[model samples]
Target: MRPGIHPASRPVVFRDRAAGTLFLIPSTATASKTIEWEDGNTYPLIDVEISSASHPFSTGTARVVDAAGRIERFERRYGRRPAPSRG
Candidate 1:
């Protein structure tokens, strides 16, 4: 709750370059560039490479690893050894 010690938080526009999306949110981060929002107001613009729009998890485009296939390949490459007899 300190007044002067905290960085000023203001409305800033974050532009996802890859997704071509813009989001207006309050942040302490500053930027040299500015952008005109839909409301006809100019705000500090921050360019980002990845966002929810383009992320694999968010878009459901993530690749599913096949553990069974990998195990089969490994067993084929190196033959499976016999289990030791329990004394």
Candidate 2:
């Protein structure tokens, strides 16, 4: 182990602003608030909603796509620009 090359394991916090969720983990608690975890340790409490902790990819929650947007229709009307192509 070098003098200052080894990675340190510190407490961190992850928060979702939208969903208003907060979690404390061992890494970098740079979100918001504070919390004392069960490992007899304390970290900053971050408010987050869709972190890997509660996201669909990790927790199997379904993703809701906004279909109300008429993407195709909007694009068909005015969503293109003349490409400046190279000769």
Candidate 3:
């Protein structure tokens, strides 16, 4: 709540290029381009590679990793650790 200490937050347009979506929200991020929004106002434009709209997990297209197989393969290649002796 301190004045002139924190960066001022203003409306910024975040464009999700992958999802082809445009989001207008408050942000402190910088952008060189500007665009006219639906409200007939121009806001700072920040293009992002990924967002919740186009992310694998958010879109329910994420694939489950084969963790167990990977662990086994790593152990085989590096040699498994010896079991600890009971004191």
Which candidate has the highest TM-score of all? 1
Q: Candidate 3, residues 1-87: lDDT per residue as tens digits?
A: 878899989999999999999999999999999999999999999999999999999999999999999999999999999999999
Q: Give the CA lDDT, 0 to 100, for residue 60 in model 1.
A: 100
Clashes of each: 0, 13, 0
Q: How far is candidate 2 from the true structure (C-alpha RMSD, Å)?
A: 6.6
TM-score of each: 0.82, 0.38, 0.74
Which lDDT tens digits does candidate 2 get at residues 28-70? 3354556676786677675655776566767766776766566
User: How good is model 2 by TM-score?
Assistant: 0.38
Best by lDDT: 3
Please provide, for model 1 over 1-87, each residue's C-alpha lDDT reduced to its tens digit, 9 standing for 90 to 100: 978999999999999899999999999998999999999999999999999988899999999999999989999999887889999
Ranking by lDDT: 3, 1, 2
Q: Model 1, residue 64: displacement in angstroms?
A: 1.7
lDDT of each: 0.95, 0.66, 0.96
